[model samples]
Target: MEAWLLLLACLLIPFVVLLIAQRGAGKTKNGSRIPPGPLALPVLGSLLWLRHSSADLEPLLTRLFARHGPVVSLRAGSRLSIYVADRRVAHAALVERGAALADRPPATRALLGESDNTISRANYGPAWRLLRRNLVSETLHPSRVRLFAPARSWVRGVLADKLLRESEQAPPRGVMVVEAFRYAMFCLLVLMCFGERLDEAAVRAIGAAQRDWLMYVARKTSVFLFWPAVTKHLFRGRLKTGFALRRRQKELFLPLIEARRARKDRISRGAGAAAALKADTTFEHSYVDTLLDIKLPDEGGRALTDDEMANLCSEFLTAGTDTTTTALQWIMAELVKNPRIQENLYNEIKATTSGPEEVTEEEVNKMPYLKAVVLEGLRKHPPGHFVLAHKAAEDIEISGYLFPKGATVNFMIADMGRDEREWQKPTEFVPERFLPGGDGEGVDVTGSREIRMMPFGVGRRICAGLGIAMLHLEYFVAVLVKEFEWKEVPGDEVDLAEKTEFTIVMAKPLRARLVPRSRN
Candidate 1:
């Protein structure tokens, strides 16, 4: 009986999709046409898109863009997805008309577990505004970020130690640094999330939980996005696995959250703020602490539930860790591939700092070449190939094409940075372009005015952690250069070939020979 029902639902879905597509097809709002692309079939929107993996989708989309202009529309299942490859169109839609295009498409609640409760996944509304403001002001604020300086220093040591130890152990082949980079980032983000300098064992447990949940969602649960009602019944085992992953995340994170809650309670009871601060050896502010304090006005001044808090913390950890780690790996790989650029950056670092101390954030601010190196990394290889998909909250027309309300829109992040029109030798890793009197001089990455390149996105929905991410990149890159001379292994040269995971990472995880520099 169950198999019969499943077969019947599958048979009915195509007609249902056709009915919806016909209703929206050739529909115009205010004398505007929807972007043109290959016609979507009855149930499967674009057969090429459905058949190709995201890694292979780029070449397919490139051909589609060449044929059907920069802005193209394709239907997949019941959803209309519009991909904008033009920078001007992206700026117009994401910046000039941000509010109309700021919202996120609805996510399957069972797949996400907490629905769209976290900031990134939440719809653009008062709740989003409140959550975003809380993060930017409370934890990610510069003043608050300064409080975590000691934490960054500690993580840097952890990274350096790991690399050094690994290099020693694997003398002939060189060390694979992606896992080290990831672990270091996880350690730092875990500290910020929980406000505890957890032991290595505890950090590894938390990191494993977060990574497991993220990989499951990115790999397994995305299938349920289409016809979730029907697919949920069909893929019950996978659905259960997703839920189990969420449960594992909660199990790892909730204890740390509750501990923070207890600390807050103790301070409230009578510990006194200064004394409480003194008693706790870790950083003063944490993401959890801020979440505990936020009262949702839209939800009648209610505090966030434990599940909601865990999800948010999960977002905070994954957001800072994966993207940053990916970017770091790409940047370091570039350094290994390009020796002259590495030496130039090392010279800049040496000129700025006198001794063998970890590069301070204040000192990193002064190194212009270091900044340029990091900027070029973002342009040449953005962490994410596409920003999170944006939904059209209302009818938004860009370049005379109508992006109707309820349609999903996304910008090609990698395409814009490599555009020949906006950049000179866009494919090359030339950090000097961002130096004074160069093509990319004074380039605003935020895409506030005009988008030369948008690594952290642009406008209202720009990444909340942009400032801190840049800082981490600069500080770590500067110190890493100062501490070691990165060289390509003789047989295994650094390969820039990329594979898309949670972010775009080197398909060959960077393995490079590290020669410790002389301090004296």
Candidate 2:
């Protein structure tokens, strides 16, 4: 009888300890109460519900949101994730109760790798606040972004030259402009990041390396995230490869960064206030410069470390390049599918241009129809299907749904972009719908109220690169339309299917015929 009692005690002890640990996990950060969420299994939590592929994720999330209401919570290990699908609930979590949801989810620390550097990955603290303020005031301020125009123009010219070469050699039907588009976008961002206009050879090498590194990171990241302990020990070689890639990127950027530092130091010694007064046009002001000059609200009175700077640089380049290029490809594919919309956009461009050389930024901005077409493109295909995961900072009741502290919150950017309730004929590619008097006029993108189509996301965590992204999209669309008349190749229709690679990118690359509008 005593032996039997000992066996039962052994089993009960483990179970009791687990129950206490879970209870501890569910409690609010302040130790008040657990946030509301679904039931969890032992170690896995709700991760069993996670789809095998990111492709399956959106539909799964949609169904879950339908069943659970807007804010549904799930626990992975000890961590809780709050999925916020309803715009109103998102508003409550991200806005009215903003402070509570201001902190970033824990996944970011590992994925972004120690972040005092990048504006996007910084936590909701004084350092982040300072970084955000500096980004707004120093670099991405509209006038400052405007200083990037010449670099943009030079890259555009390079793209035009490439397209012209493609036109001369290849049959119109055989041309796939996707690579050209990627190269052009990468060149622009690289120049912005490094402040140097790299020749085609250099640009190609850097772009190729970046692409390989990004793809590897996306493919391998889930393993690292889910089972970090086992994976790190077992997969040390692959772990090193990831770290190697990170190091490669660091090495690539270091020379440029060092050069900038040296130049700044020289200027400081020579002219002092006189040189500092003028914007240095000798070299383009790179994104690195913005990082160097801007002071963060010091953490313990010390500046951010080099590792943080490297991580931040990685984020900037990755965010700007991968997302933008994916978007450009999708936009081009859409134009190919709906030839009439492409023609309409081209006609709008033609009306504004006295001559190809005469078309300027101001002139393009005036083309309301062109702007509408770009807006429609964004609506049809948001770059990120979901905003990168956000987390709850405190226990709060949103729409009667109890959000426990430290729950991961994710919003459906693509789903919101395509919601039938907000958008009329949501599935259709009707560019006209985005016109001033059209159905999309009342659609709020800025998310001053509830989010409508959050292509750039919403609230405090919204993309600082919004203005520059828009400018690039509009500028490229205008230039492409002005230079070539896009048509679907015979026996081909644009495949608008998506694949996830840190962004919702074209499942199939866009192949289209381009007839030079200039030559015609």
Candidate 3:
């Protein structure tokens, strides 16, 4: 019966898709100035030709950007979707008039499940403000981040060891270090989140659970995100898969969260922490501890649920790990592809420290070229080509386009960074461009005043993890570069081809040879 139903659905796929597409929906119903985009047929707006997945839509969107101006308007299902590729307009909207564009779409709730404490998906208001504040102020604060030094230092060694093992185990062709980079990042973030340093098996278990669920959220369940009233009823299969993934996530994360809660409870009394983390020299508090104490203002001053805690903690782990690891691989690939840049960066590192004893996070601050390299990597390829959809809180106008209230809007992050107007040789990996007197010099990453390149986004809803992310990229990239000479394999070359998943990543998964570099 299920197979027959699926087969019937498959046969009706084309008709169903056509019906879901609203061709005339993109028309200016109010007769106001609207952004120009591809013309559409009724029942299938411009979306008739596009797929909901990022990978499938990337090329189409690129073509759309080239056709329409920086701002393009299209209708997806029943909602008017606007894409912003212009940095100046993005600045005007997200920075100058941010309050109106701060809310996320309602469909983001699909990922949160029953949890509402997630900062990334929460609506723009007190609940969001409180959760984001708890993260930025208590957990990710500069002082609090500094306390994770032990975790970072530990991961540095683990990363080096893993890289050595992988390189040695590589086939004659080469080996892919993607898993190593990802695993190291997970270890660091897991320790930071749970206040526990897990082993390879345990770490991979948590990471598997996370990646499985995120994959579903990013692709499989996105159908529910567009016109959920209809998709919810029609897409029971996707929802069922999401629920199963959610269950597995809870099964894996609950014990961890519960353990921490128990420890916190014990500490609340005079019992103190169960001496489990006694050997840890640093980090008296964990991110989960911060989440446990949070009392949402909008929720009648009640504590967060386990589901909510899992979401927040998982958000921290995945957001920090995946993005940073992608960055590390990209930076390393760039260094391998361009040995001149790698050597120059190495010399910069040598100049910063007395000798080649691992690069400390503090030393990371003084390395301008290193900073520039990391910045350039982010510019060349931001994690997401586009940020999370930002809903307009009110009808706002920008760049000669009418933005309807409650419409979905997002910026083209990759395009803005690569805009020929703002960046010269936008796709090249030249860190010097960010140095003084260079075209990319003194580039404002925050996008506070100017709308240059904002990888972490800008305005009130800017990434709360921006500060710590920067530190991770700079610190780990420094350590990786300082320790080994990343070389492109003879038979296996580094392919810069990009594949979009949760983040736009190197399609080939960054295979390379690591030769230990001498401090000389």
Best by lDDT: 1
- For model 1, the superposed segments whose C-alpha errors exceed 4 Å read 1-30, 42-44, 53-55, 109-112, 274-281
lDDT of 2 by residue, 1-520 (tens): 9999999999788866876687666444445444344556566666445544433666766776787665566665656666766777777766677777767765523643444455665568887887777767776788878888887788788888898788678774657777888889888787777677777887777777678777876676655555466666776777677777877777777776777676677676885534533254334477777677755546455655556666666677777777878788888788888888888888888888887583578887889877787788888898887776677776676666667666677887777778788778999989888776777875667686877788887777888788878888888888888888877878877888888776788877887778888567
Give me the runs in candidate 2 sitting further than 4 Å from their true place: 1-39, 47-55, 108-113, 271-284
How do the residues 126-187 of candidate 1 rate in per-residue lDDT, one tens digit apiece? 99999999999998999999999999999999999898889779877999998999899999
Q: After superposition, how far is residue 414 of candidate 2 from its true place, in Å?
A: 1.1
lDDT of 3 by residue, 387-483 (tens): 8889999888776677878889988888888888878888788899989988888888889868778898889888899989999999988898888
Residue-pair clashes per candidate, as listed? Answer: 0, 3, 2
> Given candidate 2, what's the lDDT at residue 121?
58
Q: Name the regions of candidate 3 deviating beyond 4 angstroms.
A: 1-32, 41-44, 50-55, 108-113, 225-227, 273-278, 281-283, 518-520
Per-candidate Cα lDDT values, in order, are: 0.87, 0.73, 0.81
Candidates ranked, most accurate by TM-score first: 1, 3, 2
Candidate 1 whole-model C-alpha lDDT, 0 to 1: 0.87
